[model samples]
Target: MSYKQILYNTPPTDAINPSLTTTDGTFRLSTIPKPSNVPADKLLVRVHYLSLDPAMRQWLTAKRSYIAPVELGAIMRGQSIAQIITVGSELSSKFKSGDWVVAYSGWTEYALLSAKEVEPFSVPAGGRPTDAMSVLGMTGLTAYFGMTEVGKTKVGDTVVVSGAAGATGSVAGQIARIQGAKRVIGLAGSKDKCEFLVKELGFDAAVNYKDADWKKQLKEATPEYIDVFFDNTGGEILDACLARANRDARFVICGAISQYNTSKPKGPASFMTVISQRVTMKGFIVFDYAKQYASAVQELGSWLAQGKLKRKEHIVPGGIEGAPQALVDLYKGVNTGKMMVEVAPVSEALPSKSKL
Candidate 1:
């Protein structure tokens, strides 16, 4: 059976600040041709969901980053949930037909990948793999490693997370709390978001950066000073956190969503604070800790299974057609949690023995 897929066009001139028109884009949903002969080592998956991340915005731009920019006319790069439709070898016995899996399938309905390219999920019988893509996947791993490893959070430490209501930030704050933080302070863009951080997500304190007295509020909220700063939105908020850091504080710079669209990236103007406070600021890419991913996933999965952690995802359904705008929404802070677009229904067919 054939499937529909959306293909991206030429890259935008102003990829940093992409608009629908300037991006020179098109949404081509056409039938994907089947391979003449399926490779003996490849697996075919029917994608069910596409994750929309802030990082995607940065990837669209031809900038120097840990990862290379998405080439023009290529499928937009993304992480997604898929079901194994066909397997190519017995060596791929780790998965089977009807098995739900997660893969870097991009924004397409049907994805052809190598067995090494996909991670099989042992969903609870009838559960979906989207759960694997969200709570048990990259977003979870990002929060786990970025918080526990990079931040080096300790019990009784005052942890502050910028963009605290976002996908990574929200999970990071919870992880800090689970690590026995004295106080978990969340900084979000709006009052409602702050409310969600405090009430729904169990953050000890929530401050809205939009407040006129945001600096004062941040200061008041963390009277003991921030010991571990998990920064998702850089710019003024980062500066504020820097100004309020305790001695030898750990600042985990995960992403700078605030600067992604700006022609010029803005950071803390003062290094004197870093010197005076003796702050140890470091940036990390999630892929850097790939070796520890299985351990992290296991721990996070246990937490999730035991109800010690909660996962949130703002799901937009419409397959590949919804991916681009969902990315735009991610930058706009319109999504409340882990942002993802459901592309298609999970496949029910099992892989053939020869294919496997």
Candidate 2:
């Protein structure tokens, strides 16, 4: 059996699918027909790679969020790299078949989107289109603004990043170092991931959050206490960082993957530490920095050239068929870096596997 697309379904709590891919209770492959023709205002492209981010989990909920939730039976929403297969007559002058671009292509083998919905992407010097999905893409931009604009990392600041081995958190930690933070420590799930952070990624040290002595490990890692906390996991880690926060430290809340699956998400028990420590805690969405993206990209691209920034992408198998389980595996910490699915051939070179 084959499918032209995949559809979003009721989540685990409200629904479930027995298929192994949909075991997490979200999506299922569908046999929808491909569009016979492209509209004059839109273009059709075959998806090459689709980014699998933790944020996609939040998009499944019915609750009010930064963006509207996906409606059941609709295409699952996502971003992807694609080669234009056809362009509308109106856009033919500017875009053509075979032109590679990025767009909100959803979880399908092909996407037909408006000219405004798809944009061209030029691989920067020493960078590949795959980087667009990892470092040079949303993951990188999220880290850029979260560190510079929100965290305001300084030369003397001792920075701590939870979920430090994941895409956004990994890049966020490096960006903190690039911005001159005195010490950069990471919080990861396992000893191997912790070693990856400290040895491969240049983190000053790392704490395995799953370890029995992790809290003591955290204290030992940040003796001067944390001046900036870049959080991707928000439960106990957030509470721990709150208690260890230096006065007026900045906490950049990029995500809360730890709480995404829980019915009653735990609020920080160290809530009073925010008051006592006079900490500045803020949650941010990447789109909030749209106006400043160009500058961020320029600087990030330069770092790519200078070797100051590196990236890790975990490309799962089975093409588009692999996406649902790949997403499910994200919360399982199966991927040590950015997670993606290659539905078709990508135009850029990617490392055989993530170094971290």
Residue lDDT tens for model 2, 1-356: 23467788667662224253544557777776678888998898878888999888788888889999988889889998777888898999988776767778898888889887777777665666678777888999999999989998989899999999999989998998988989999999989999889888899999999999999999999999999999999999999989899999999999998888777789889899899889999999999999998888888888878888878888886688778778778887888888888887653323222221
- The candidate 1 region of ten consecutive residues with least summed lDDT is 347-356
Error of 2 at 163 (Å): 0.7
Local distance difference test, each candidate:
0.80, 0.84
Clashing pairs in 2: none
| Candidate 1 local Cα displacement, residue 284, angstroms | 0.6
lDDT of 1 by residue, 1-356 (tens): 56666555654443332233444563334576766555678888878788888787777677788899887667778888777877777546666766777788888888789877788767642234566776677877888898999999999999999988888998899899989999999999888898898888899889988899999999999999999999999988899999899999999999888887666777697567899989999999888899998899888877777767777778887666667677767888887778888777544434433222
lDDT at residue 154 of model 1 (Cα atoms): 95
User: Top lDDT: which candidate number?
Assistant: 2
lDDT of 2: 0.84
